[model samples]
Target chain A: MRKLYLAGAGNVSKNLLSLISNLNSDIKIMGIENSRGQLFSEESLSMADINNFMKSPEDYRKSLNISKMDFDIYVDMRTASKNGERERDDYINLMKNGKHIVTANKSGLANFFPEIGKASSEFDKKLYFEATVAGGLPVFSLIRSSFPSFTVDSFTGVVNLTSNFVMKKVNDGMNLEEAKRKAMEEGVAETDMTDDLDGTDSARKAVIIANSLFHKPMRLKDLKYSGIDENNIKKNEMLLAKISMNKEFSVESRVFTLNSEDPFLRLAPMGMACSIGFKERNPVYISEDMDGPLETAGAVLSDILSV
Target chain B: MRKLYLAGAGNVSKNLLSLISNLNSDIKIMGIENSRGQLFSEESLSMADINNFMKSPEDYRKSLNISKMDFDIYVDMRTASKNGERERDDYINLMKNGKHIVTANKSGLANFFPEIGKASSEFDKKLYFEATVAGGLPVFSLIRSSFPSFTVDSFTGVVNLTSNFVMKKVNDGMNLEEAKRKAMEEGVAETDMTDDLDGTDSARKAVIIANSLFHKPMRLKDLKYSGIDENNIKKNEMLLAKISMNKEFSVESRVFTLNSEDPFLRLAPMGMACSIGFKERNPVYISEDMDGPLETAGAVLSDILSV
Candidate 1:
């Protein structure tokens, strides 16, 4: 029986749990530290609160009359690292104890990749987190598996869903605040969904691309992220209409913005970023393949699949 | 004979040339506007330039010593509508004559999707651009295929390769100047790659995506684009190593970043955008019956084989 441990049952975490029932029968959950409720229907080896379990696991599990649980992997589904002290240590501890770690918890990895890498190195454990960057997007494996012949100039994309939804609302003519509120109501975004506007999410995703695909674990503080949620674009409907994209086609992608702008003229109104594969004044479409934001993600997805 | 009338001899046009050989042997290139250098093969049809041929079809084809060359599909692969004054009349003219348009050009359809929809209502001319927003990504079909039951929340990715690369170079320690030069020299970039930097590239791709996938053609100007230029990054090799990604991964799907900072305590790093699926985030993978990015592309390749 392949025992697994899961930490922090947040939105994404809950989703992961629901999928576990469809998991290969070879895998089973033995422990989880979610307060909200159980996500995966595994035999609870330790139901004690994370705080108590982190400080002393034996006592916590003992109360439940469980002696020893065999967990092959640990999945951390927490979305952020703001105040997750025990969640962090507990995950680390599990990994140190010959257990692998797979997570959708991008925040945990972003802040502690180097240290985790160091520990995983010493402990000889594996860590996988495909859902960290893009929820369902296959980013990690893209870089991990690719064989180089083709050079990667850079990578960029809408890595943050909250902001993505917010941007979509703004394009739909809603004010920023209203758009944000709507995003949260839909559960696609949070109160702090504005963080995407600040570019922190995109930048964080960028950092991961840099390290995972480029073989560089960058310092988050060093990155300069500018979000699309700035004061400049309040509600430019005409521009939005002309450049706005229809939302009907992108049900999976769920993008809401117009992309029609005069390329010959120097005026640009779409969200974008850069990398090493472009120069001169290429058209946006051409530049996308030659120098667009989604390249790294595309490449990494490809890479991961090959691997 | 199955013939394809290639209109513009730009990237898609040229790329299509390469693709023709891979098609069924019965397919042929009946009327090429210009007898320019072969994109891949030396064999082709009417080699008259578009404008010149349009001016005096008989004279031009006569010059080439042709008896008859009736085209079934007028393949237009010109710069996007975001470009300068395109001859919309020419496209309409082709459609009026019952010629279908297969294009990678966004402007023609994006600029006039509604008009085209209305006109095609009566004319019954089909227009297709499989390589628009994310080249070779099957964006339009994906949306058209997955309708009503599915809802799109946001569409975001490293849409422009030039920008992705530029950011990669900046993270690599090369100043904007150096990265741009290298990109051009590498043939991974376009002549006017700078246009990619202004965010227009992504905007255009986004617009096309919005229109084709979402049925909402967004004006590029309305998009709140945020570009990552080199003035803000370092040219240090060490830093580059810290935040490096490869092109192969990004070119696959979305999610291409060097280091993804996790909101949760940094547990791991993975790039590639993921959408919330019914069960897992990689729903596209599952729904499409593919496991990951490699499978996605591989399946497409297989479809080509089966076809």
Candidate 2:
């Protein structure tokens, strides 16, 4: 059986545990580590233990014995970091200890890809991050699995569900703050909405896409992005991220109003969609109707299985 | 390096050859077998040789030396067989000779899955048939790569583009015969449109989907399907294939009119789409704007690389 050690006891990790419990999978969760500390178990954790951990994660984090834990994969469900230093260090350390990494956290990959890539290669460990970009949309997975030897010329998508929901609500006559508050209430927006509001989240995703798909080394600082602002927001406008390769790769995330007949305009409030342009064939469009912790957990599970 | 042997020198096989020519792939086409005879080459065929074969496939089939040919993968792009006897025998022979099978022919798998399944297991060789259903839509690839442990409950789709185009044209006041002729002229309908028009094509695809996705063994005779007829086809009606798993697995293909608000109804003329219902999650919708031999060749190439 493949053993998994979750790096964070948060919503995505809890959902992943529950999801795994319902499936006839060969995966087992042997440990969970949060900021409080770490929890290790010799055998796979049962549903009752998972429930207890969910109820009081702090109490379960009493043991920080990492050297004794025998796990094959390290799952990172931690919250996004601005600088990604802590997540990068954690990933490198875990990889150095002979653990494959499956991550939903984007910041570490977006900010310090060269270091992480080098470490992963040097350690001969695989890394899967399907949930980092468009949660559960299978953007990276599709490209990796289906489009072999096909050159991706560009990618344009509405990848941020929180900002998309907020913009749609604002377009429906709600004020900016009210729209954001409604999004938060509906679990569409995170408690810390600064990244979503300032386009940093979308930019980070664009950076990852460029790095992975276009084979271009990019960083968050290389992108010039503009998020939704009350003064500049337009009716029917939503955040869009575009990554293209010409003479060089360009990544941008900006608030733009699509034409009335544009398919991106038809996406649901929580929907995420992408149009991928290939070298000589017609562009392929992919979209999902919803995005959340559950969906991200599903993506994480997919990566785990792939690992 | 992978050596691929084409079982048919048809449109899809020719397209696959050309597509591989343009890519920096590690795959090589070592031989091609047609109804006339066989063409064998010790070295990988060049683009010029591929073009020559395309011009007059019969001229290149001078040798029937299958015993001397050394290839790793066998790709089947032959026309649909009504009974699938020949294709089944060919697949078994190839697998027995230690060759992995990748096919675009649906009839063999649809009609003789048990034999093929047993041979594949006995030989311990891989079988990739992504091009058999939905062309390049990546339905099977997505399920294989992304939904590892998820239970697929049902699948509904507008899979046959020829029938869809013919029905749409007839709905616009054109007679059924003229619409079918137009479709053929547009390269959407095949010269032998019996299988496509009589719903056998859709039923075969339904059988493949049911067997592959639901893990239920099904055959074409097990399905009750109706094709597009001038007297029976209603306005805005198109062929739809539905497969469900209840007390037992059920497969059906029939002509039906989708509501105007239905997303499947909004698909382009040559588009193919499928809605996959999972056990406890939201259904995923996948669609492609176009389907043809080139797209099928793309899928075939993908399978070759995977092998």
Q: What's the C-alpha lDDT at position B110 in model 2? A: 86
Residue B47's lDDT within candidate 1 is 33
lDDT of 2: 0.82
**Second chain TM-score for model 2:** 0.93
Query: What docking grade does candidate 1 earn?
Result: incorrect
- lDDT winner: 2
Report residue B107 deviation for candidate 1 (angstroms): 37
lDDT of 2 by residue, A62-146 (tens): 6644634699998989877779997788889889989999999998998987788888999999988999998877887777778
First chain TM-score, candidate 2: 0.93
Following a full C-alpha superposition, what root-mean-square deviation does model 1 have from the true structure? Answer: 19.1
Error of 2 at B1 (Å): 4.7
Model-by-model DockQ, in order: 0.02, 0.49
Docking class of 2: medium
Reference contacts preserved by each model: 0.00, 0.38
Give the clash count for model 1. Answer: 167
lDDT of 1 by residue, A165-266 (tens): 565566567887887778677655556654566666665565555555454555456555555633445433111101111232110111224334322111
How far in Å is the alpha carbon of A124 misplaced in model 1?
2.5
